[model samples]
Target: MTSDTREPAAPTLQPRNTPARVSFWSAASGIGLIVAVVVTPMFWLPYGSHYTFALLMLGAVAVPAGHLGRRRGKRPDARDRGLALFGIVTGWLLILVSLLVFVVFTGTLAALGLLFGTLD
Candidate 1:
């Protein structure tokens, strides 16, 4: 039997050249959702309703932004896909809830007016 003279080489770890980056549109979408939530209470303030609607419309931008963000996140070096998805969901929820509230308020007002014969 021949004696082994050479030692086996140790395993080596490869270093990453760059860190993954968070998608910008994803961050923007998340920020937009936060702003929308914060502005929701303005509906009760005088002349604030218009601003609230405008902000909500602005928040709707997140939907498209989130979509773009999600696509970006699919890349190997991009991140924050979950944040993008959250933005998309919250954006739709805010719009739907606002519409529901508006419809309910108008319906209730009409019912009250009709009951009191004030609608004519």
Candidate 2:
């Protein structure tokens, strides 16, 4: 009996040339959900809320910055990947921060609603 000792073929890794598709609606809904969670605190604040401007600034700075700074992975004249990575990280950070802020905001509102009679 002849014994075959051939090594198994290695799997090929397909090159990822296509950039991730970011839709306007998905982004918008994400922003909106986060905002709904966070913005409720403004209504309960004694004075005009300081958090309003913070949310606005987040949107103003993060959304466009994120969109404008996505990675162009396949371009011949692509800029440093570090910058793109930074942008992606920063974008995610902003999204997470928004989510956290919204959570606190909504919780505070729910507490207030329970205290009052508006929760129904």
Candidate 3:
């Protein structure tokens, strides 16, 4: 048999079992929802009928982010699906509440205007 002169081939590296990562959007959505819930009440305290448009803005952002987070969380490498769902639910709730507040405020203003004969 001829003498083997070639060096042995190096062993291939194997992939390690790494832990899955949390989705950033998911975390952001959740945190934002929480903050909106906590801070929005403070606004209500100052004026029960004024300065609540911020809730609409926050809900608008959180809803989309939560949807994206939920999609990402579906992947095997990402996590926090529950938090994403929570964000989505709370965001929608906030939007509903904000809309109701706006409607009431506008109606009250219109009624006052009519009463004072300002809307002729």
Better of 2 and 3 by lDDT: 3
The per-residue C-alpha lDDT of model 2 at residue 21 equals 24
Error of 1 at 100 (Å): 0.8
Segments in model 3 whose C-alpha atoms lie over 4 Å from true places: 1-50, 118-120
Lowest summed lDDT over 10 consecutive residues: which window, candidate 2? 17-26
lDDT of 3: 0.62
TM-score of 2: 0.40
lDDT of 3 by residue, 8-87 (tens): 89986543212111223433544565465577776555765433566666567667777777777677656666766766
| Reference-based lDDT, each prediction | 0.59, 0.50, 0.62
Global local distance difference test of model 2: 0.50
Which should have the higher TM-score, number 1 or number 2?
1
TM-score of each: 0.57, 0.40, 0.58
Error of 3 at 111 (Å): 0.8
Residue pairs with colliding backbones in model 2 are: 37-102, 38-102
Error of 1 at 87 (Å): 0.3
Candidate 3: pairs in clash: none
